[model samples]
Target: MLAPTGWSGRFWARTECSFDGAGKGSCTTGDCGTGGMECKGNGAAPPATLAEFTLAGPASAKDYYDVSLVDGYNLPMMVDARGGAGGCASTGCVADLSRRCPSELRVGDACRSACEAFGKPEFCCSGAYANPTTCRPSVYSQMFKSACPQSYSYAFDDSTSTFTCSGADYTITFCPESAPR
Candidate 1:
């Protein structure tokens, strides 16, 4: 789908889905909880790989984007900027994190973030740990970062995870292949 020049949105893949002729059904992963094929402005359920984008707008000259596993991870995903200037590098988590997901965070085919699994302030980066200085990466987020250095392993990983570009289009690829690290 095409978005306007200044459009901002997120995208993700849905797995193990079944929809009837009326476009009503659910997906095992990234369902969006709308109970239908269309998300209807609903965000994906947790344990999903997300590709978020904020296109250039009046207040900003550059576009910002990232492949985030902060909510968790269900699959490998990548985002590439095409024909952009300044920091148009590719970024993603092509690694299959589910294979190495911690036992407590494992959910069938997906992996839950530490925050989702425990709901602690340290893991969720909330309450007392709501800032970049206070919300440091935990062991689980560290492991995620080790596996996917370009992905948003935690909420405060903006420095290394977020990318920027100007005057370009993006291509989000699910299950992108890259040489093993």
Candidate 2:
């Protein structure tokens, strides 16, 4: 079997493989296919490579430049550390938001809220499990209700919890659109 081309993980391209300018993903979001190119100023060479996707492209009126079609290809993103250019390198590129941790997750957001909504309590930050044990079995059970409620009452070890499903830090294996409305 010629390893099923685009048979396993082939995803649909939002447009003819190109950069997305809309930012909000009104257009392409992933898998730009396998195109390649190199771009530059007017005197630039006739692109030794072609681009696979336009992060923001000539179509969107972003400054035209060349890029490789290969995914994870490294290109010198415009701007330096501290997100500036020239002089002290330490200060430049600091402001570049690409590849940095997102603030929402870095902040206090957690699946615990969703767990509480489902009725599971004290599942995430149970604090100290000794003494009064705020994470008591009752609360733990409640937390599980919020985190994973598919079959919370069952002794079945395979049953899942709401916290397991809604965690942003981890991808919880679940049926798409299976959450309660």
lDDT winner? 1
The deviation in Å at residue 94 for candidate 1 is 0.4
Backbone clashes in model 2: 32
Off by over 4 Å in 1: 179-181
lDDT of 1 by residue, 28-97 (tens): 8898998998898999988899999988888999999999999999999988899989969899999988
lDDT values for all models? 0.91, 0.22
TM-score of each: 0.95, 0.17
TM-score of 2: 0.17
Worst 10 residues of 1 by lDDT: 172-181
TM-score winner: 1
Worst 10 residues of 2 by lDDT: 161-170
**Candidate 1 C-alpha error for residue 172, in Å:** 0.6
